[model samples]
Structures are given as structure tokens and as C-alpha cells.
Target chain A: MEGPPEIEKREFGVGEYGRKIARRHLSFEDERKLNEFLRTEAPFYISYSVGYFKFPSATPMENKVLLGSDLVFEFDADEVGLLSERDVWMCDSCGEAGFGYRLKCPKCGSSVRIEIFPDPEREEKLKEMVDALVKDFLLGDFGFGREDVSVNFSGNRGYHIHVRSEAVYELDKSARIELVEYVTGQAIEPQYMFGGVVPCGKDTPFLCVEGPSPSSAGWPGRMARSVLNALERGDRDLLLRAGLKRKDVDALLANRERYTGLIGRGRWPAPKMFPLEVWANIARLTAPLSGHAIDTQTSADIHRLIRLPDTIHGTTGLVARRVKDLSSFNPYRDAVALPSKEVTVRVRIAPEFELGKRTFGPFRDEILQLPLYVAYYLIGRGVAEWSLDSTE
Target chain B: MEVFYEVPFLAVLEKRKDLLPENPSNPPESVLKAASTHLRSILYGKSRPKPVHPSVFFTEANLVAFSPSSFLWERFARHYALLAVPAFERREEILLRHYPPSEVLSLKEFLSVQRPFPELKLYHLEVSGGKVYLGRRAPLFQASLLYRDILRWISERVRNIVVSGSLDDLRETAQRVLAPPSGRKRGYPHIQRLLNVTGLPDGRKRVLFYWLIPYWVTVEGKTPEEVLELANEWISRQGGAKIYSSWILSEAENVRSKGIKPWSVRKVEQIDPELVKLLRGMGAL
Candidate 1:
């Protein structure tokens, strides 16, 4: 099979390019005020939804703070290695777009423009992850309620969960660090969740059944229930997938009634006859899935400012719209904010992408007329340039 | 004449080089020397403003006896009580000069009689050969409780001492101690009032007087003129109240150390005029 596609590499003058796009697409008053506000406010740092300005003040205020702080998490198609599977990207340096992973330009070897487009499956997974973090961690663990949390589409690959609670607002850096650690499972000792190792004779192999008590709440309870369901199902393939060894699987199956009895009573047994290696394997596999994959730095930095809701994301030309009902929120349908004025531009490379309710083409080098938002998105990404000599 | 003499209530045990001694009943010269050295170290370590010496009585036989009525005894007995000697050793007597109705008493009686003192408490007692050791027991000082209660206690104690003393003596002592050295000027009216009211005494009172130095300098602004100016400014901004300068200084230091800028008006209100004036003069406002 062919490896990931090579897309060209070139660093665009980010601030200048952003300014150009803002000037062209945004109202003259909006562009002037955004610049003026940025110049005056002078935040510690300003990060666009795309790239960040390390010292925004040094270069004049070009970045705007979203009205509220954002907690962004990315499920990049390229980062998650799903470029070849579902999403597509275009090379900005040499206009080459396709439905495959491209790191460098095929034509000119310049940096590729990977528009952070949505995938239904990946998007679902991302939503589930964020929902669990909000519901289980922020709400259940930290005592935040539904009113305190607001979820938003980041207008690209991820979701932004903004927490606005007076209780959490004044938390210092160290307290925030602790909160991050708890949510991300940093330095969480397995021995803390599972009990100490049982001592068996040096010559004899043993397996220690140690996990959260079945009655315990949160991840522990969830894990316990999942393990119980797996055992009750008694599928050999499931057992194998759970990292049980052949010998251990046979032994467990043979004594299924006794094992089930122990589990039912919430008593984890340390059996000398069972293999210790198999238990360790199962623990290794289960532990990671139990931990919530949260962005620790974003949560830990108390001074961090996030994307403003209802503002347009520079990269995707879609609004970072707030989600009232997170369960039914679809970024593709709901986040489209730009006007639908049709514009014709040279199509370097366009892939089949779903915008609003329509699927637009896998167009090649030919010039094509597309909706204003779509054309602006491609232009902003530097994938397609406005045709100077085009006749409408 | 029955004279009251003060003495060391506790003795340090020394390390022995030889397992067997020439005199089984008495410690060697080297051991005695080491014990004396240890005693000296303890005396120096716990030295207060007024240093008191350990009282010792030498008998015709050159046996040393410690006095239980000395200030040292009172301090030590605040935590410790002596162990009773065995019945066989009851013949050995200790002389008490001023103790009522008893010129002589057995070591056992001495141990039991010592219990009458309220500061002394019963702990463990150990007896080996001819030597006896007393274990001291005192209530543990909880640091959290200490932090909360110490300031209030100091304030109450100082106020009581000030109110009870003669005004003339308090004024004289305040003038003598609170007066700035050489070209340095006297403090403000509030500080002067606080100083004049806080009466001084002998050596012990001087220590308490010095303990107020940090608060005095910080609040009163070194010179009397500057102190008055700052105090007036403070009174203008916030009305005056009975201020505990030390507590105010401590609170300001605490807030400043936390990296908060421009002290809050509420916090400023908690501080006395002297401290607020001092902090304001120092541009910490």
C-alpha cells in the first residue's frame, strides 16, 4: 500500500494573511474595530483558532479574545491518522487536494493545507469524549452544574467546552493544576484503584483480582460493570481481546461459576493457580480506557484565554457557535456562519466535502464557481487563489 | 536562718567509658564534667532576658543537692516530676531549709511532696541501681491553635499589664525605650499613646518591649513628623480604632507575599493607623 501523501511546506505570514482575509471578508468597520480593540486590550498572549501570537503586544494587537474563555480539544484527522480513511486536505503551496493524508505538496513539495474538516465517526467520538469530561469530571467530580458549562463547536476538528462559574473563576494556578491532574489521571497509581498485590509462593504463579469495588461510583463503577458484563457474556474471543492468556482463559472458563460468585459478592480473589502475567495484561488494557483523555495544559493554566463563541474561526470560516443542546449539536450544520454569495475562483484542488446540507465536488485544476463561504474558506486556507483574470 | 535558695531541678546523665566504676555508687570525674557541660548548654540554650543560675547545695560529704524552690525548678516542674526512690533507699535524706514542717525527708517523700505544685504532672518514673530518672509530661501545643490564639493572648496580657501599672512608671519607661536613638525623631501621637500606656518592667518587660519593634518602626514611620503625617492621612481615608500594630503588620506582610498589588481598602481598614500610615508612606498603598 502507498504511504501517506506528501504535501508542500511553506510558512504563510500568519498575521498579515489573517489581516488580508479579515479585510476582504469582514466589514470595514469590523476589521478596524477588531484591530483597535486588540491593540488596546493587550492580553498576555493572543492565539487565533489557527496559529497563536506568542507576543501579541510586540507586533501590535492583531488577535481578539473570544467573549469567553475556551477549553479546546482537537481530534485532527492528520494527527489521529485518519487522513487516508475519510477526510481530505489540500496543498497550499502547490494546489493539490485529495481524499488522503498529504504532508507535503505532490507538485512543488510545499506545505499542505489540511482544513480541519469533520468526520461523522471521529466527530461522534470527540463529542463523547467531551461530554464525558463535562458530565463526569467537571460536573460530577468538581461540582459544576449544566448551567456552569457551555459547549461550542471550535469550527474545525474539535469541541470547545467553556466553564463559567464564580466558584472556579478565582481558582489559582496550583488549584487549577490539581483539577487538571484529577481529570487527566496524572500520577494516578494503579495500586490506589486496585489493591496491593497478593503474596503467593515464589515458585507458584498467581493472579490478583483487584479493581474498583462494584458498588463504587464513577470510572471505577463503570469499569467494574464492563468487566462483569464481559465475564457474564463468556465469549472466548472477548476474553482473548481482554488480554487473557490461553491457559488463564481455560482456567477461568473451567471455574466460571466460582469466579462469578466472587465477583457477585464484590470480593476480588487472589488465586495462586491463575497466571499473574495475564492479570497484568488485562490491567494495562483496561487502565488506559478508564482514564479521560483531557487536555491538561488548557485546564491547568489559570490565565489561559479561549476562542470566543459566535465568532468566525479563521481556518474553517465557520462560527465557533455555542451549543445549547450538546447531544443534538452537529458542527457541519450548525457552525456555518458566512453568507452564501456565490464567487468564482481557480480551483487548485477541491475534495468532496459536506457544507451545510450539500456535498461539493472533488474538483481539479479547473476554475469553479462556489458559494462565498466555501470559496472564502479555501482562499483563507491558501489552497485556492482568486482568479485575477476570470470573466463572470 | 531558713533561707530560700534556687537550684537546678534536673541533672544530665553522662556517657560512661568503663562498664564498671571505681566507686560503684558515684559517677566518675569525666562523667561529671560532661554532665556539667551539658547543663551549661541547656542553661545557655534556654536563656531569657533575665538569666537565672542553677542553685546547688553542698553537704559535709560533698554530695550536691538541687533546690526545688528555684525559678529553674518552677520552669522544669512545669512539665516534670521526680520519681520515688525504693524503700531500701529511704534512709538517704534530703534537707529542706524553708519547706514547712520538714527539715529532712526521704527521696520518696520528696517525689510525692513535689506533686502539690500545680505545674508539675505525673509521667513515667524509672529506677535503675541507685540512679532515678523523671519523665516530664505537658500538653502538646497545637500550632494551628497557637496561630489563632497567640495574638489575642498577647494583646490581653499586654492590656492587663498596662492598665494595672502606675501611669508615671509606664510613661517614664516608654520615654526611655520608645525614644528614637540619636538624630532619629520620636513616633506619632497614636504610637506615643500606645507606648505610654504599655508599661515596662524589669528585664522580662524589656524583651516584650523589643518584640514590638517591627510593628513600631513599620507603623510609626521612624520619625515623629512622618508618623503624624501618615497617621492623619490614614485617619482621613478610614476612621481610627484600637489597633494591634503587630497583628496588622503580620497581615500586611501576608497579603504582600501573596503577590497581590495595591492593598485592598478592606485590608487597610483592618490595620491600625500606624501600620496603614507606614505602608502608605512606603508606597505600598
Candidate 2:
């Protein structure tokens, strides 16, 4: 569950100022209501429920109003573990560009700071998250058809995917959490498939052990396939990264054909060939690789109010636009909401930020004219002020 | 709970040759050989599986099957952990006492009387005396109890199971089974806040009422009568001008026919004050 989306907007001129935008539940499955809310609350950032309610206006809070929900997955750059450069600050005193958080410019031997923003063009984590949600978990394991899923940029720091089918909508909060756990591979334990021992026979008390066949279902199959992939491609580094020792990697490579064949049939060799722990280790190590960076708490929230499609996210003043082709759609270029014409603004401080085709400032207490989109963005960020001329 | 996968029965048996039952119904050696090899190739080999079922490829074998480990989890949920405790009565007798036929949904079709999934391969393990072993006489297990199957069970129970309890009990059952939390309101401040708004226009006055309702009827899965009762209950509680329940009932009908869902909440706060509240509550001040 989440608190309501923000309806308050802050505009910075001489200082920060507030605009009281009434929170309206638009897009309530009624076209006319959506249009009205948009017209009335046009300029304020809009957020919508991931839930499908009985009364969209009643607000999706109590269990009663929430009829069903759309499966939403979030990929935030801050959470994705990608160190994409946010914004670079330059030392105006020394004309030197800065990279990290510092109070002044290092070029002037002073501390200068760097502000991080998601680079629209180069978020490979987006690709990983997409593949994890759409290809691996949803369609591959859960057997959801392609028509059931939709992927789009979150329009700010990340992307969001919506799995909307009769199946998805019917899922309750626990089931959704389970799905999140499955997709992220958080609950995966290698022991069931590889480590723990189960009886081979009822009569004979003989203990037997084996691993998942490469084609097994669920995480077992996925883990086996991932290991097989590393083995088949002779990815020594990948195997080593998967917690295998150098000698173990060499052994796996040496016995590649036999091992692959055995693993194909749900059998692993005697402990003499490799320690029993190695199989579990392979499973433990590889399951995470199949997992992608998804913000778990947010996605699992059935009562969440997600940013409505085509609405502007307050952060960058960028439209939380749906990306038709995430690979091709650049947020810096396509998601910009304001006009391109130049507007004058006074910057107290800002990191060097970019938009569309133009790069703006590493402005520190300077007056300059920038693109309207850029000015709105700076003001939205609360770093710049618009001072009126006092001629009259 | 029961777990099912689409591996061929014979293939699963191949790993546990000793567990094979006498007078098995497996196809002839030639059919078995061809089908098992094909299934293995479909899974183990590099080639992606075709969209066709294994039955389509090997009509005679019909070797495709689902295996279940246990339904212990479902039983645990059903009996509210009572099944875990030992009693003088037999387990079945105890279960019968708790889930009488009058109260229980007759979802026998899911058990194996119908071919909802593939063939069966039960020979699951027994963990007695801290040693892993198999049952002496392993019967054929049918239901795979995948996540969807569990959901099907929940919905079936909610829609059909006869409950003597009040609407609140039924609603609680739906919430508990569907969401199954630890019953902590700690994680539910958002749930509380969602209904925090009060004293609104008629259209929005029943926000909390609309928020906590549950569906009972089968077709469309939503009933208008319950909507009327809940709307009136909420209306009676309000101190302001009387709001007509007829409007909500008609509104519910309009929503039903139009294929649109009921009302939803839009967010009001700009920042995640919940995070701030959490931080402050933790004595970070």
C-alpha cells in the first residue's frame, strides 16, 4: 500500500513557492471523468491506482473498492545498481567539469558536488528488467501470453511494466508478492533441486542424488539452463563468478561433454568428480543472475498509485510517457514536455544537465536564457529562480 | 501445496525406477521410447519446444503428466494449523469435522475425477524420523496445485462455500485467505490512510464503504444487493444530509454493464510522507 500521489507543486522564482493542486482521481475507467480530471488538474502531476476498483472515484483503499489489480513492475535507476552519471557540475571559477559529489571544485582544490540523473539512453538494467519480467518470469515460466503484458518507461528514473490479463487482475496481494519473489528469484533456494537429499526407493534405504534436468520447470529448470548456458559457451569467467573455484571451472570445462550430458538427464556425477556442494553452489550463484533489479516493495503493493500514462512526473518535468520501443525511446529527447523556445532564469545552483538536443548549465548563481523545458526542469528541481525585472 | 509440472510420467519414473507400480498403463516400448526421447529433446536439447502438446506428437502414449509433492500447505491453511496438532481422532475424521460437506465447496472435479491437467505421477517422498524415504504404497497424484490452482480454490470457496458467519466473517475470510497477512496493522497505515478522508460529497462520501466491500455472486463476480446494504450502512453512519442508496446501486449497475471497474483512489501527497513517517517513528528525530 502507498500514500496518495503528490498534488502539490513547487515553483521557484525568488524562492520556492507552492501551487495547491487538488488531487483528482482521473482515468477512473470513464473517458469523460478522465478528460475532466485532466482538464482541471492538467498542470499538476497525476498518479493512478494499480488497482481496478469497483468505484474508481471511491479510491482504491479498502478491500471492497479494489476489485482487481494490474501487475506493475518498477525499475528505478537508483535501485538498479547501475552507476550512470547523474549530472556533472563544473567549476565556473576554474572552467573545469566535475564528476562526483564535492563541496568545492577539485580543479580549484575546492569541494564540488555531482547530482545524479538517469541517463535515458544507456540503462541496460531496463533491458534486464524487461527480460526478467516479460521473457523469463511472465511468458517463460508462468505461461502468460504476449498479449497480456505491456512495458513502458516510468518517465522519470526508470521504467514500469504492466501485466494486465484476467489472470493478473485476479491475483491478490499475497499472490502478487509471490510473483515478485519469483521474478526477482528472491525466494529461490538451490537446495531443493541440488543440495538436499530425498529417498530414491522405499524398500532399499539407498540414498540418491541428482540435479534438475536442463529442461526442468520453474527455478530448477531456469537454474540448470543458466548453468548449462555458462558451461555450453565455455564461459570460464561466468562459472568462476558463480562461486566455482578455478580448479572446479577447469574440471567442468575438461569434462564438459560428459557433464552436460549427465546434467541433461537430471544426474550429477559422484562427489569425487566435484564436491556435492558445488552443484548447490552453482544453483545458489546462478539464480541471482536470472534475477533482475525490480523494486520489490513498490511492485508488490496492490494499493499503489502509479504514475498515470502520459502524465508529467514532477521530478524532471518530463511526461511519464509510455515508451513504444524502450531501446529506441530516449527519455531526454522524447519525454521533454515543455516548449523549446529559450526563457530567462536565474540559477542559484545546478549540475550540468542535458535535454533534447541542447546541454544546459553547471550554473552557480548566474543569469542566463535556456530552453523552456530546461527552465521548467531547473525550477521543478528547485535549483533555479525566475526573477521579474523591476522596471515598472 | 500440490506442485505440478508438464514432464512426462515415464520420464519422472525413469529417475525413480524402483517406484514404478506393477501393471503400469504406460504405452508400448516403441511408443514410450519415441515419446520420451522427443520430450527430452524438447527440454534438454537447444531447440525451442514447438507449440504443440506432447499428446499431439505421440497420440498413443499420452505420456504428458503432472506430479504433486504434497498438499500440506493448503491443508495447513484450511485447518488453520489444526492439522499440524495430533489428536485421538484420525486426520481425515478431524478434517471432516472441520470442513463438513455442507460448508465445504465440492471442488472434487479438481481432485482427479476430471482431466484438468495431464496424467498423474504421485510416488512422492516421506520424511519420517528425520530420514528421507518414500511411501510404501504410492498412489497416483493428480492435482498439481500450481499457484493458479490455489487461486482457483480460493475463489471457488469464496463464491460457493456456505458460510453461517456474518458478511464481516465472509469478508474477513476473503481478505485473510486472499491477502494472508500476519494480521499486523503496522504495515497497513496506507490502508488506514486510504480511507482517512471523511465528510465528502454524496458521490464520494461512501469512499470507505466502497473501499471495504467483497463480491459474492458468481456471474460477473459482483452483486448489486450487497452494494446497496453496504452503501446504506455507510449512509446511516454519516451525520450530514442523507445520501440515497439508490444512486450507488444504479451506479454499480452502470459500472457492471459498461465493463469498467469500480472507483479507484488517486494519490494526494506529493512526497512519500510514509517514508518520512517511518523514519520519524524509528526515533531518527
| Candidate of highest lDDT | 2
Report the lDDT of model 2 for residue A355.
82
Residue-level error in angstroms, candidate 2, position A266: 3.6
Report the lDDT tens digits of candidate 1 across residue range A1-392.
11101101101121233542221111112334445544664222223322122332232233422122223333333343334344456665555667666678778888865665556676676677667667766666445667777776766667767665555544444445544544444333332244345433335464445445456544344445555666677767767875677887787787777676655544455635543333333433444323335555666553343554565667677777777887888887788877888878886666666777777767667787788788877776565778775575
Fraction of native A-B contacts kept, per candidate:
0.00, 0.00
Query: What's the CA RMSD for each of the models?
Result: 25.6, 24.0
Output the chain A TM-score of model 2. 0.75
The alpha-carbon lDDT assigned to residue A155 of candidate 2 equals: 65
Q: What would the per-residue lDDT of candidate 1 be over residues B138-239, giving only the tens digit for each residue?
A: 111111111122223223534223321222333333333332332234333333333333212212222112222333344433333343344334433333
lDDT tens digits, residue span B70-109, model 2? 2321232223223223432233442343222221111112
- Model 2 clash count equals 33
lDDT of 2 at B133: 25
lDDT of 2: 0.50
